[model samples]
Target: MQIALTKKLAEAVGVKAAFAQENENPLFSWTANWTKVWDNRRTEDMIVLVNNATRFTVAIYQVKKKDLKNLEVMMKKAISNTLLFMNINPEIVEEYMRLAGDVELVQNRGRQTAAWVSKAGLECSFYVGREYNGIEKMFCDTVGSLINYNHVNITKTRDEGFAPYQEMINALTELTGKPAYKYRAFELSATLNLDVYKAVRRIIVPANLSFERLHNVLQTVFNWKNYHLYDFAIHQGDKYDPAIRVVPNRECLEYDENAVLMEGHTLSEFLPEYKHILYTYDMGDNWEHEIELAQVIEDYDKESPFLVEAIGQTPPEDVGGVGGYVNFREIMLDPRNPEYKEMKEWARFWTPELSDWEKRPRVIRL
Candidate 1:
């Protein structure tokens, strides 16, 4: 699609080129470690990308033939003026424009894979946020239209700080021709925490969870290193500590305009997509660290369940190494001690058990 568009643009401007290149321009400069894989895909011929520049991505199309300079000139102007490089109809343009945004491209190429000026370069395609593709584009356009028509400034924060999510869901429901009480954003927010936030952002919000609530939540939990709490809270399973309980806030649901009260109320439906975005966003530059933590937990549980169980069974130490003969509690609590190692080895020591007399005494560090 890109190649054909660039080729046509080249012809329109009466310029000929033998080959063309596609480049992707990223909205920002800081690259998240986990997203590196996806970012790398932008380098493919059909999709060239530039990262970390500003708020938008630029897709550049290189013409295959270099001789038609006139076509190149016309195409460059068309792109600069936000004209349709493709011969699609007004209806398609309106739909595409609503979903995506204006077309952006370089007016001219300085050199092969070299930087080009936008004014002189030929434009080939429309510019939208990196997330705006296909279905997402449709949803964004439809919802955005509703927001615009309703006179809701999505960019602004409401008096209650709840208006962002309310506005988004309200707009979405209106576009879908459903009532405002169809979805429950706040209910989903209260129960799901970060994982649900990540999932819902991908599916419903895609952008972020109403900036205000998401900001507060992230500020509190962002850099926390408590791996157990992070996992237990985000991933669904048996509660880590039975005594821990969450205090629910029903304020978001009380209002008619909020997303949580929408017609299709399915927490399950909203979780994964939101999570995908959150994980991708939060892990940004430090994504590797998070992955390592996740992998270690998974591997320990699988490759050596007995050891993991032993670690779990071990009780907390009272006073750091006070008694002689080494307390079982102390050994269990101490990760670096040799006693812990022996316990791990001994737990799996199925062939023969170590006799009490033969068991070595715990070594005391000076």
Candidate 2:
């Protein structure tokens, strides 16, 4: 299959193309600046053609009739890998796919093809067949069209699926305009409960912090081991209208399937609207914290999460949520109790003193 593709691609592009396995990187030096073509056969039985000068790549998947059911999956993997190889963000590719009107490529059949030009001027094409005639020309035409394509207009037209993301980006851009020396920061107090006896930690985090980063800050400030699953649920009014749940990739099944990814979104986007949020950590323990945005510091230039104040010690992780923590706390406070010494030692190890709080703010790197 790969040999045939190599021969056909060579014939169509009028260049000597060779069959290279997925892991193989063949060296080629060309005199022309914008006409270099490279071919590789992926381990998944797909042929990838990359033109370095044009910043264009094509993934050709030769599917058998029996494998038609898995064509969409194959195409997605191929496209994703191609984009990764081309140093393109999958999100941008997703936006392009949405604009191109065939995100899943489910309707693509034998010899069907799709092409998209990225915001960074990279052209990507997907072909579902062995036929290579005119494929090069198709890529060339797509690149030509891309040269004059209005990406912002395309984004506006296909703005339905990505409204929330776009809104978040716009809000962030507005908030962080011009990248001044100081950044807008959020002073948040995350309390385990509203009761007087509950554990509480006051933190000042950058407005651009993502939910994932918030999780890490909570873990560090509270001195809790990151051994459990967690999520953040935003609320409006009495009902939790729209929440951004951030769970470990493996534990996503535990929460609502429609939850937004916790990585891309920044705290600034949601904190301004929904000032109150519920952060649940260790699902089994049911440790819920009420995260309130106490204040927004406009002149703060810190890059990390800073612990301002802490009241009471964070319960030892896996202590079975609030109820278990209460029981454990009771046991630790009583020296006569059988678990007192062991539990106290455990608490001392995980809980940090007020002076021990690192002065450096925690920064979330994407």
Candidate 2 lDDT score at position 258: 76
User: At residue 321, what lDDT does model 1 achieve?
Assistant: 19
Backbone clashes, candidate 2? 4
Candidate 2 Cα misplacement greater than 4 A, ranges = 1-180, 194-196, 237-255, 341-366
Model 1 misplacement above 4 A:
1-45, 49-55, 58-107, 110-332, 335-366
Q: How accurate is candidate 2 locally (lDDT)?
A: 0.49
| Residue 103 error, candidate 1, Å | 4.1
- Give the lowest summed-lDDT range of ten residues in model 1: 303-312
Please give, for residues 235-312, the per-residue lDDT of candidate 1 as tens digits.
233333222111122443443223232222322343443332122122222221111011111111111001110001
- Steric clash pairs (candidate 2): 304-361, 304-362, 305-361, 305-362
Please state the error at residue 42 of candidate 1 in Å. Answer: 16
User: What tens digits encode model 2's per-residue C-alpha lDDT throughout 282-315?
Assistant: 8798787888889988877443366777777677
